[model samples]
Target: MTKDQLLEMVRDSTQVMTLRQKLALVAMLSMPAMIAQLSSVVMQIIDASMLGHLGTHEAAAVGLVSTTCWLFGGVISGLATGFYVQVAHKIGANDAKRARSIVRQGISCGLAFSACITLVGLLIAPHLPVWLGAEEAIRGNATLYFSIVALAMPLLMMNSLAAGSLRCSGNVKTPSALGVMMCVLDVLFNFLFIFVLDMGVLGAALGTWAAYFITMVLMMYFLVAHDRNLRFSLDKVQKFKPHWDTLSNVLKIGTPISLERGVMSGAQVAISGIIAPMGSVAIAANTFGVNVESLCYMPGYGVAEAATTLVGQSMGAKRQELMRSFAWISVMLGMAIMALMGVVMWVFAPEMMAIVTSDADVIRLGTEVLRIEAWAEPGFAAAIVTYSVFVGAGRTMGSSVLNLASIWGVRLTLALLLAPTMGLHGVWIAMAIELTFRGIAFLLRLKFRLKIRE
Candidate 1:
């Protein structure tokens, strides 16, 4: 069926959808989102490959600060989620006016929030590499690269808000298309700055900054001026005023998510610290391994995005059975796809590592760790999609607690104990074990704990 027809099915609360119909709808929504996610990863891969040729240190510098960057990005996701999930609920309840108001307030509030984070990032940029235990030689590049990306934080926040708004509105195709466009722009800009201007790590950051800026503008324009439901000029709503109820709901839903992402990303930063003291080769290998793994797990995130939209709308419509069905379908589909991807990654681990970096030591180490990670994909998929289900139902607190418990209680503790003895391999082994455990926990929670209604 066409996307328009599929959207109709989503909105048709009375329609008793067949199994084929449900699967088709999920596939339609997921394919575009999956492509968009992969494109974002490809942009990273391109940056790493370009920097890899410049020498191991340039790649290592970015690697050193990557997790810290994710920490900020996670906050952006938290802010956007609060707004877009509300938009989805409003639309599902057939309240187009309310959705538009939420969109406007969300943009304003999200910008203000991102500005605070940008300030914090800027203040810490210079000191971050040192804190992460980077080699003295690479610290300067790491600081410069992070500072450049920090300056674009507002753009990143807006991009996320716009994309989330679109996805919740069932306009996944637009965001996915823009994502591909952003990747193409990244290639052009990276070549201009990195090759033509002879900039190294600094060039990579600038290239990414320029791409995000341009796409954020286009994304916001489409969301605000073009989208049928959320178009700003469609109604006489207060554009910037924050309604107490809406704002309160946003905070209630977003706070736990922000905290979850914050701590989870902090754990990643901590892991980076653990790997940092192992020297540049180990750092680069860990970095490359993460990039390759993204290739396998990003599709799971794509399915998760679909789950959030489906579940949020289902919840809004008070369709408990439909919500449960969508949740199960999304998680099962994600697991199957990622399980297959795990095999692909395991078989081609060496080739993938070679594409990212030329250094034999880095490639060998990254390949070994990546194969270890392959075994964790299905479990990782389970965790990723199930969490999105929780977020969609506005039941984030329990999942967030479980996530924090798993990451800290299990992953970091094991990594700390194992890293000194077995090196980077030990750290990855710890990660695989933790992911498998976390997945099973989430699956049980989905079956027993998640309430269909409040």
Candidate 2:
């Protein structure tokens, strides 16, 4: 058979699967990743819930520092996306050696970048809470939490690199499985350190650090032990040298993705700063609401990952039609899942907030925000899944530009105008409006782009 015939067979095989089959495949592929993602979010909830017992001041401290850590973490993860997507494309093209080389380069880059983040985060640790306008009562604990996370930067970055590399090669299960394990371990460790030992916020940070270390080790094991195309060998080290061309390619795709995340992180910090002066009640309430919202939103992210992989592989195979199909299907799946979640959140908002805190005021504020954001889930789902499609197609520049514009131009602008007048409600309103705009823009782009035909 000719090469075209072989390619046709592969495409036909994948396409022939039923819609239920497709959803199942996507779920099976994304479960571990989803579980892992869920675990991280669970840890956050657990951390806050545990700290909530300590007092609102302690819970507020964790909330204040959490966004900054996300910002730092986001930048590293963004950098990893650069290499991981390339690996996905390469593997789809049947270039195993090239894919392995890219993984090595990613490791080298992750280490270097992690070191820089560690240095910068440590330097800013003491002042981060102050910068965010934290009250005197929570500032010390906030600084401690921030410093511990900063110290774990290397481990977190390594874990991200390993997970991203494995997932790109079409082995999402390993990373996802490890992620669940990490989450479980995180909660267990946090329970021991925080409750039993009474270590406070520092204990929570330590639990996270330990969890990341465990996940990174497991990820490294899977990459070496099971990944056929990704096994590292000393002999290959002799052949390895910095390939500027490959590095440049990875960075070109990755930098924009990272900047998109980094800018969003910065925007979170800015938004936090804006909300800070509103008092600790507003700060704690917003933080809890955001975490609760993640329960609905994260599944959309899981579907988005599947979209990235499927679309990236399709593009690599030069099956442009498949790419378009994958994009639409993924977005629909994301929207459907999240819309369902939104309904659940709206109906059970009080119960969800209760899981995080017993504070009457915090729960009251959080439930209100959750109910409002629930209506915006479909838009959020569309934006996330479509952005994954663009990233998979190596359209990072467009995705980045759109993300920055949506957040800074639309979201922030609306928040500035409305926050003073509406308080926390204004922030949620701005988010819903911006998400709607973002979703529409992405859908329009997908419609206009020339479809890839077999």
Top lDDT hit: 1
| lDDT for each residue of candidate 1 in 232-269, tens digit (9 for 90 to 100) | 88986566878899889888888889999999999999
- Report clash pairs, candidate 2: 32-176, 320-452, 321-452
Clashes of each: 0, 3
TM-score of 2: 0.94
lDDT of 2 by residue, 349-420 (tens): 998889888899999998998898999899899999898888877778887898899999999998999999
After superposition, candidate 2 runs with Cα above 4 Å error? 1-24, 233-240, 450-454
- lDDT of model 1, residue 440: 99
Weakest 10 consecutive residues, lDDT, candidate 1? 3-12
